[model samples]
Target: MNQSRKLCQLCGLPLTEDQSFLSLLGIMSTDSNNLCEDCCNQLVLINDIFCPNCGRLQATPEMCFDCIRWQNKGYPLLEHRAIYQYNDVMKTYMQQYKFNGDFLLKDLFNHDLIRLIDSIDKDIVVPIPVSHYTMQTRGFNQVSGMLNGQTLSDILSVTASKKDHQSQFGRRERMNRQQPFALSVSSQLVVGQRILLVDDVYTTGNTMYHAANLLYQAGAKTVKSISLAR
Candidate 1:
């Protein structure tokens, strides 16, 4: 089958032109989405009862312990929303798309993500930037790639190249993480604007805080984040 005819990006399964709903409605839809039904069903989306601050799944809607600690430490209260849980399937997907540099794999989540981003009210959308080394090797920032060519603020930048990653650290180390980002442009643009920070995953959330802290200091009115996976 021709690749243009729409095979699932993850499993390479040949997709029908449209699901049976089209036949029932007698409406022809031509949009070719990436993931197959089986692959889509495997994703564990975050539930309504989750931490309001960090978007972690929970029995009730409340701030998680980590978010409480963040507030106690004088960090600004930044609300976050995550689309899916970082389960074994998500881990494998991240490894293949990000670490393994499978560029096209981003299409699997792009449409869903764009729809989610659209629902949020923000003056600017800023994706966490990748280091120079990472961009050279990975060929793209995973967060930016997930936005599917949408216009995003390029204000935040990774200042220095460190051979370290947040995933390499323990929880304690992540909590003590130092600032890794800097503003590339003047803060005048960010002042008094509601900002939405975007990233591929939310681990310890050290990265988001690092970025939000700077944005708040730069005069952002409100800061919120969205990650594809928690």
Candidate 2:
């Protein structure tokens, strides 16, 4: 019998244990598998209702007050959504990707992102960029790699930087990325196009707001944003 080779569910990249980037249990590194260990975690955490507006997991079967207020206020904050709450499970995996050099979680965590938004019609996928410091330390943009494209466009580019701002949350980790986010489409590339922005997380959304604002200034007519988890 000919066994079908396992390919990454997100990027369609072929996986082999011998040289796989990471390993999942019961999945031999020397054998073919669909995802590396980092990606496998995407499938494990489930069974919860996250607020559609803020994506916060709830304990009492009630809507998140923050999301409710956000909606009432006309969503000036953001059209935010996430698949999972930042529970211990989601938090551990995110830390692994952000600090430990596992870029694979982008696909694991955001597998449904583009699929859900494709119907809205976007010409480009702009990833939110990390500051020069974080980029130097992390070595890559997790946002850029998450939608690393099995089906999205082949071109992936980031074009601007905004001045970092103090964070509202008072959490240093949040402020570490305080640099203003920026995105530029060549005047020729986006005169009247609709675009969607992608990012790994959406906390205060200052980043998304700044990025969308830049894209809009560059001539985008409509902008929608998405993140893997908040």
Candidate 3:
């Protein structure tokens, strides 16, 4: 679609056109039109000064306290990157997309996610799986939809549970979550392969670590991660 005619994915404002000659080359892509100027400015992108391990926005490029603690507690540390800081704008977008089940909102970061996934050099990308209950209620796995056609290995599934949302739990409770994820019985495909885990958000890092632990035990050679927000 043409830029001026396209509605912003987040705010629904009409976008301005890119009059550059690249438009004629079919290279002036959706990135330039999906987010209007105002909504774009609201996004706080992660800078070089963020945590190297978890991508948490911080003053220095050191591993965040949580990641350090994870290693101390005998969990394998995941090298991570995030596209945006978890600010108020991201919180609102997450609520609208994940909680409210607005599946279309997944495109809000489509272009960026494609770029991020393209840069990652891994044998396979595995999106963190949601529980069956979440799939039935929310109608989709939020992380799975944001994966823009990368190499996917569906190696994990959430075990049946009666648990509440992760966001509703305290930090200690979140960290203490039981093994809610399990490898598919046929998931021997990741053996000795580099794996990259993708998820929508990194709150306490519990969920990703849980999946990574399972992947590592299942014989994955290495495990890294990327999330849309941190």
TM-score of every model versus the real structure: 0.86, 0.59, 0.88
**lDDT for 213 (candidate 3):** 91
- Which 10-residue window in model 3 sums to the lowest lDDT? 19-28
Model 3 steric clash pairs? none
Model 3 stretches with alpha carbons more than 4 Å out: 1-5, 16-30
Instruction: Flag regions of model 2 displaced more than 4 Å.
Output: 1-77, 104-106, 150-179
Is 2 or 3 the stronger prediction by TM-score? 3
lDDT of 3 by residue, 1-230 (tens): 45467776676777666422343554543354466666667788786688888988898877878888998999878888899988887888888889988888887687777788788888888999988888888899898887766667788999847465675789999899887799885557878889999998988889999999988888899999999999
Better of 1 and 3 by TM-score: 3
Candidate 1: worst-modelled 10 consecutive residues by lDDT: 23-32
- Which has the greatest lDDT? 1
Q: After superposition, how far is residue 13 of candidate 2 from its true place, in Å?
A: 24
Which residue pairs in candidate 1 have backbone atoms (N, alpha carbon, C) closer than 3 angstroms, thus clashing?
none
Collision count for each candidate, in order:
0, 2, 0
